[model samples]
Target: MKNLVLTFLLTVITVGSVAAQEINWVTLEEALELQKKEPKKIMIDMYTVWCGPCKMLDKNTFQNKEVAAYVNENFYAVKFNAEGNDVVSFQGKEFTNPSYDPAKASRRNSSHQLSRYFQVNAYPTIVYLDENADLIAPIKGYQTPTQIELYLKMFANNDYKTLTTQDAFNEYYLAFKPEFKG
Candidate 1:
């Protein structure tokens, strides 16, 4: 009886932990709508279907337990395909991929207007927006869990407000301690 009870308790704990570690990704429109009710900073994972580094980031960094938990808690995460057909409305404007070919959905298609709007010329750009849905920064390229953890914390904690100069940013970067194990 004691062993059975312990096993059931362990199973419940494990399931709950796994559930909590998941980053609840919502569509851009849904995120915007949710912000109207409960505001939070947004993090956009901008990527193309054919991008290799983007896949790596999704599999490695985004899947990391610490990365998933922090991003889930602090931001309304959006997985935006840069070259897909999804229409996103932002700042009183509607953006779409007019030239996106349906047959090449899994390959490289036309870039979405939102990607162009954010000037994302590369894959795996992490675009951060303030709680007011204003652009904070569009960081380009693939980042490890540890590398992204710093930016996540910086923006989440409003530490970016203090780093006005390049030197200040450098100092902040140098002093950042990464907690993401994966």
Candidate 2:
């Protein structure tokens, strides 16, 4: 009877841990709406269906237990498709992919207007926004857990504003001890 109870307890613990591993991904509009209520910074993951690096980011860095926990606590996480037909209402403007082709949905479709607005030249761009929903910076490409932790902490705490010069940024980069596991 004790062995059966232990097995049940272990199963419950494992299931709860697995459930907490996911990043709380919301839509662009949802993030903005949430910001109005809670006033948290926004972290947008701009990805494409045909991008390999985008998939890797989703599977690797974004899925890391520490990464998800930190991001969930710090920012309003958003998953935006750079080349999809989703209508995004941002900054009092309604943006959509007017040229989105349904036949090419799985491949390289036309870029969304919101993607153009951010001027995302590459896939897997991680765009950061202030609590006011203003653009901060867009870091392009795939990032490991440690690599992204730098940006995550910087943006979350508004440290990017103080690091004006490249030298200052370098100093901060060198001094910053990453807590996220890679």
Candidate 3:
């Protein structure tokens, strides 16, 4: 029947949409293992379920094929929920959300200690780390697809190590594209 065919089509579309939204994320431990085997930088997307900008970044920036491909190729990308209950061990320390309250979901429980360890002050914070698991500064707030591309290229090419100051980075960034507004 026509109704049956329409229902099937809608189901398929819903499934496809959900699949597209799903990110291929690895845990911190898995990323560390990969880093140990090969020298690749790490990009941690520190997000919370209730954050709007974080959802936008996932739907827009991270979903972009170019951004996803570059991240997959150059770094061990880990999507970490700030309020998650799982145990995260980093730098010989175990980080966990010890005060999680399922009943009061509105107030997203305390962020894991790892969130503080990385100094994430806002939602949708992206923490970039070097090959040795050293902090390369946490890029706070939401970033557009193009903006993320710039950082990915800068860190991927090891430009961050050479540029000591923001002014120097801006100079180099401008030289690359003088008309760039951001």
Superposed on all Cα atoms, the candidates' RMSDs to the truth, in angstroms, are 3.5, 2.8, 4.4
- For residues 48-67, could you state the per-residue lDDT of candidate 2 as single tens digits? 99999999999999989899
lDDT tens string, model 3, 1-182?
A: 99999999999999888655344579999999998899899999999878999999988888876677678889999999887777988878889878877764555778878998999979989999999999997998888877787788888889888899889999877766322222
Positional deviation of residue 4's Cα in model 2 after best superposition, in angstroms: 8.5
Native-to-model Cα distance after best TM-score fit, residue 37 in candidate 2, in Å = 1.6
TM-score of each: 0.89, 0.90, 0.82
Better of 2 and 3 by TM-score: 2
Rank the candidate models, highest lDDT first.
Answer: 2, 1, 3
- Per-residue error for 45 in candidate 3, Å, reads 0.4
Worst 10 contiguous positions by lDDT, candidate 3? 173-182
Q: Candidate 1 — number of clashing residue pairs?
A: 0
Off by over 4 Å in 1: 1-20
Sort the candidates on TM-score, descending order: 2, 1, 3
